[model samples]
Target: MRKHFFGSAERLHLVLMLALTFSTGVVDAMGYLGLDRVFTGNMTGNVVLLGMAMAGGTSLPILRPALALAFFMLGAALAGRLLRRNGEGWSPQTSAALLAVSLGLWALTVFVLLAPVQADPTLGSTVTSALALLMGTQAATAKRLKVAEITTVVVTSTITGLASDSRLAGGKGTFWQRRALAIALIMLGALAGAAALHVHLALALALAAVIATAVTVTGHVAHRRAEAEAKTGAESPSLARD
Candidate 1:
């Protein structure tokens, strides 16, 4: 049981997913509290908000969520294209690239947050929208990659999976622990991010960028090693014959 939980590829996938989940929680919390309650990671909430805004029923405008959804789709589409071009083997590389992009965007957001620009409502809205879109894009890309547990943008599906597969529901325990762990990590990250925000918003963004960069580096390393092994095996006479 211990080996199955810790020595499996699923475990590694869960670790990576946990990292992304933490990042998502941090970013989403920042966006919601600091950016006027707009969710950056969860596009579903953003879509609903967009509709409400379209009907002129809320202070939140529709354009921001609309742009976020568009960017998210674009990011997912990009991931799909990469998958088609490189196959499942490219999942790590593609995910790393998307995370790298997300890190850069988050860094830019931090810079903007520290800038001397006045806090105008319109500008705030636009900037918030852009950041939210970046988050959505990151989330969508993760989803497209089908990484085991790292769908870093939202928890609705995770919650659904947990409840639907609970022992009380007469379901097997497969992946249930992983799902619960992911949710917990995300919540913890959100709390940490909120604390950082209380001290400094720029600091929170910086922290998020750091996490993303770390994931990018690790994913790249793992991908290269896997690719090298694949190449080595392909060239070996034994493997070739098989």
Candidate 2:
């Protein structure tokens, strides 16, 4: 029997990535709304906010967004360096990276719960930076998974693809299902995050952390199962020849 509705491991990776896409929306919402107008996951939004801050004439923060961008790049660089030797698709490195993201998010969640960002500027900045770093790590790990157009962090390209590749655009509308799902999931995640913030920032971070943990565990199990099945298939072929 197939292990999932999308039977292949490759398709499973796409679904896993879509989950992370949702988590990214949650993280971004927490950052933008709770953490002083910063974006932890959506670097494109962060960049634009940074540009506007630099342009002057507003009380918009410059330092926090700038720090978030820096830490995010650092996280991506570190994750990429760690994953450089691995080939496409999930690996031990992918699991480790995701686990690290999970841990980081949980740690931030606890910290926020203990020291509410509204009470301390330093803590707020620290949480914001940490979230950015974790998000960057997640983005890199998802990229390594190579689930095609599902990048998990930003949906701009997915939107563009959905529109540009539509039947109205004189092209065969392929992969629209995943693309549309990615877009919708991110939006829903953002809504969830915002709603959670009405209660507490920690709740939002905790939700993201939980999703990260789930993704890490599920992906690792699926990868191991796929590897074992391949091994069994190879052995069966040799045994048949004998």
Candidate 3:
């Protein structure tokens, strides 16, 4: 189990994806509170809100959710195209860095040119669309990584996994630890972002981008180290045989 854990790319990807999930939570909170009542990452929430607005059950603008949903699709489309071109050469870190850098720039623009930009409904919508785009691209790219029971954009399945895979549920509970961590990290991120909003709403996105960038660098280093370790292990076995 130790060798499996150390040798497997799945474990590394899962850890990094959990970080991305936390970033998603931060940005989703930023979108809902700071932007127009939209969820930049969680499409489930956006869909429900869109339905309610259309049903006249809420005062929320339909355009907000519609725009967020549209931009998210656009982002997913962009990721699909990039995936086709790069094939396996493209790593999750690459997509994450793309998103973090773009969002970082957007956050800077909001800070510099559009301080308190959320008060301007039109500009907020535009910014929210951009944020949703990054999130959707990230969601699509992360999906390609093929980790089980965890998606960075939402935790419905992760929660389900945590419940269903528990030892009491007649399952081995193998992923309970990671599943629980995903939920915890997302919740922590939500709390952090909401608190930062009281100070400066843009800080949420900035924090999320910083976390993404850090994970991107960390994943690269971890991948290199795993490769080196695997090579040394392979060589040691061969040397002993020789």
Which is the leading candidate under TM-score? 2
Among these predicted structures, which one has the highest lDDT? 2
Q: What is the TM-score of candidate 1? A: 0.81
Model 1, position 199: C-alpha lDDT score: 73
Candidate 1 local lDDT, 90-147, one digit each (tens)? 3665665566565666765566576632256566565555566566556655565566
lDDT on C-alpha atoms for all candidate structures: 0.67, 0.91, 0.76
State model 1's lDDT.
Answer: 0.67
Model 2 regions more than 4 Å off? 1-5, 240-242
Distance from true position, residue 214, model 3, in Å? 1.2
Clashes (N, CA, C under 3 Å) per candidate: 0, 0, 0
Writing each residue's lDDT as its tens digit, candidate 3 over 1-242 gives 12344465677778778888888888888778777678988999999998888889657778888999999998888776776544432365565545554555356546624455766777778777887888888777777777777779899888998898888999899888888998998888888878888888767877887877776676666656666786888799889989
Reference-based lDDT, residue 86, model 3: 49
Q: How accurate is candidate 3 locally (lDDT)?
A: 0.76
Off by over 4 Å in 1: 1-10, 54-58, 89-96, 116-118, 234-242
Model 3 RMSD vs true structure: 3.8
What are the runs in model 3 whose C-alpha is more than 4 Å off? Answer: 1-8, 85-113, 222-242
Model 3 Cα shift for residue 105 (angstroms) = 5.6
